[model samples]
Target: MTEKYRERVCNGYDHVLTIDERLYDVRTDHQHLLIFKNRAFGRVLALDGVIQTTEADEFIYHEMMVHVPVLAHGSVRRVLILGGGDGATLREVLRHRTIQQAILVEIDPSVIDLCRQYLPNHSMGAFDDPRATIVLDDGLHFLQTTHERFDLILTDSTDPDGPAEMLFSRPYYAACKASLAPGGVLVTQNGVAFLQLDEVRSSARHFNALFRDWHFFTAAVPTYAGGIMAFGWASDNPELRQQEATTLQRRFSQTGMTTRYYTPEIHRNAFALPQYILDAIGKTSP
Candidate 1:
């Protein structure tokens, strides 16, 4: 690698292809998106340097996220996605014909611009869809202000810091609940399951306390900071769909998306926590 091949701000990834030395915006071969596949994280959107999704396995993260709570609440039509600049989650969300609208709230225009230029394939034609509304602002603030009710709210923000920290706060959670229409479902990326156990458990505890029905679920995504990722859901009675597998199978594939991940068993197991995770939740007791 020559000096020209390297960048001034190199955020490494596990896999990245150098399209052009001086291209400034070098796009990847498989995804057709420009990224600096950094040595550590494998691929980040080239301009802003936010990891768009990883080479190892982005589907696991995307599929489980868009499906779980969705399948849990089958009547979903309007959806709100907070902080998914990558567009993968939006892509996954759009797969459901049941979804009439998808409002994506991302803080950085640069991230979306970088992703639109780089991670196109990861999200199909998500950005191009007329049904998707992209808003550049703080998600927490949007939730607090928007009285528009949604059937499902998916918060796929960055790690539990920076501009996204408030999304995990109690006030934001309350706002999310208020934004839900009747039996609305709320789900969020609860940080790395293994490394941020406290954050995950605390989030779950808070949700469990606030929502009459809420539970923590986990999925495996190889590219994330941790191999395991956790998400939480809340409703009135904590009643997840009885037949998540069947519903997803008929609805999603009907829309012509044969998903790589998200199965009924996986849906069940994602919520099935180990005793330690349970004890971990208990340890944080007040």
Candidate 2:
């Protein structure tokens, strides 16, 4: 039999992975969902022809996204996560003993259900935690209407296209900013900087206008098909992004959490951007 393969083409880059087994393939009301097993990545999930997450390196992305802001704030009691239906982000947030509530707003219920069933390790029973509140609504609507405020907000949505196009807009970012408590921080999955420079540039512009401090951080996820992935960071408190490594280490130690890819050193260094990337995002420095 011929080998099966899947190719993800984005921003002039093509990433092809061999499919060792076909698990689930369906078109939900909102988007197409595909899950397959690969020799290198274990279980792979793709939404709307874009690679969302894989078992091998999910820790890298999820840990950096969740821990950086949470640990930096050092007193985050409430967290709001938008569009992380896969639950990895929630899992990371719930690891912090300081977190009292974690509300996840996802537009499509199918993504949550199917991901829980098919990508069980991605969530690892996070959906069943008592501290977790799952809301089946559009993120922007939830942000606009919710009275609750969070110490940290994470936008784990897909790329800026199709169902998620509005998420990367200025209004959506403004809504997220409004939903934050004082000293709160907002982090977004801003796509890979090498190919998706415009996405970072747009978010940077919005953050510049909205927050007292704004910057981008870098992480390398093998399946994301770009040189380095950038996470958008914005906050009214500039000091949150300037925490000393010792302070972050103290906060991390108190949580008693073990991470694979995230450390105080890594968190501190992620903010150091290359000149080309800084130029692309229209910033000279962090």
TM-score of each: 0.81, 0.97
RMSD, one per candidate, in order: 5.8, 1.2
- The residue ranges of model 2 lying beyond 4 angstroms of the native Cα positions read 1-3
Per-residue lDDT of model 1, residues 1-286, tens digit only: 5322222222352332353332236433212334555454445453323344654477888889888777767778999999888789999898887788999998777667766665566767898898999998789889878879999899887655556778888888889989998878888887666667778777877787789866677887655544577787777645554445677566545566666888767886677766666687763221
lDDT of each: 0.71, 0.91
Candidate 1: worst-modelled 10 consecutive residues by lDDT: 2-11
Clash number by candidate, in order: 11, 0
TM-score for predicted model 1 compared with the true structure? 0.81
Model 2's TM-score against the true structure: 0.97
